[model samples]
Target: MSGLGDRILGLGLLVLAVAYGWTAQQWPEPFGGAEGVGPETFPTILSVVLVAGSLYLMVKPDPDAQWPLGKTALELLISLVVLVIYAMLLEPLGFVIATTLAVGTLSWRMGARPVRAFLTGLVSAVVVFVLFNYGLDLSLPAGLLEVS
Candidate 1:
């Protein structure tokens, strides 16, 4: 009973990992045929890792696991809401804007000053955007920033 919640969470994550991997497999092949790594590679790798972690959690539930309450619970709720909103707004607002807002809000909740948190978010988002769009050649939504 000590880690009942952890066990349940692990089980849930295991199911999610399976579904995620399955969904990744469903993506259509690239037009010219998948060369090196396709779009599904990263998600498939993540799902595999998640499955391993979930299995470990199920096998070794933390003996001292404690559920959050009061302020801590509220923070968790806020973070979840932010992530849900981030996903919803990603396409419309573009990766950079959506990510900046999500990261900034989460950083602020973690006690960073508002200005500094948002600046950090902006920098990180831009860095990631460049890395993915330029370095890796993976395109992320440009959202409102689209040139036309």
Candidate 2:
């Protein structure tokens, strides 16, 4: 329950950031020239920010940092599991369904009532789905909801 916890967490996050940035760089160039920003741009930027934060956390971690325990630890584990599942399900169940499930579970864990939390997740997911797919003209997989 000290800087050890923060150092460990920061190291783990730094590893993940490096892996993410490396994977992003593996993406092929877009159809048009490499003139415009490509698919890797945003992810690379995020990874860079993550790397910086992780470095800061490792270098000057809070000496009194305490890892979560009991209920809080359980909640964190549940959230992590949900996120992993959401990522796996995204392609098969589609963006809206996957996002709703992940967001709703997280919201409920954060103390929102089940009904309101789920409703909020559904509405937010649908809104983002529409915005990304239609407004931005970037298609999201329909998956099980795909039209024949």
Candidate 3:
């Protein structure tokens, strides 16, 4: 991409980061404060980091870096399709199945080997499921499998 394009993308991302931070700040404190941090603290920190990174990119962009716009658009389209399919099939296919399929498809589209991608996807899905459902005590849809 051109320098101007990089600057534009960076500025856009920075704006989004600021907006996310502002929204997080406006969110009601549903979860009680813990010691010094609240539930919104992590998201706020992430937004700040995003803004800082975008600013850095805008200021000192690498000249040699080539932006593969076409490839990126294809990848984005594939990702969106995977996400939509995952959502639509989540109830019937179950979380594990749907998530595994989505992740595998995305990984393959990104140039991973089929077998390796499948295993990686399965592991990622299971780990995420366990982390959110058990570790964080978040209620996620169990789907048909009822793994939860």
Q: Which one is best on lDDT?
A: 1
Q: Estimate each model's TM-score.
A: 0.96, 0.88, 0.65
Cα TM-score of candidate 2: 0.88
Tell me the lDDT of candidate 1.
0.95
Backbone clash numbers for all candidates listed: 0, 0, 0
lDDT of each: 0.95, 0.88, 0.81
How well does candidate 1 score on lDDT at residue 90? 99
Report the candidate with higher TM-score, 2 versus 3: 2
Cα RMSD, each candidate: 1.0, 2.0, 4.1
Write down the worst ten-residue block by lDDT for model 2.
30-39
Location of the lowest summed lDDT over 10 successive residues in candidate 1: 33-42
Residue 64 in model 2: lDDT = 74
Q: Candidate 1 residues 77-117, lDDT tens each? A: 99999999999999999999999999999999999999999
- The reply for model 2, stretches above 4 Å from the true place, is none
Query: Which number leads on TM-score?
Result: 1
- Model 3's TM-score against the true structure: 0.65
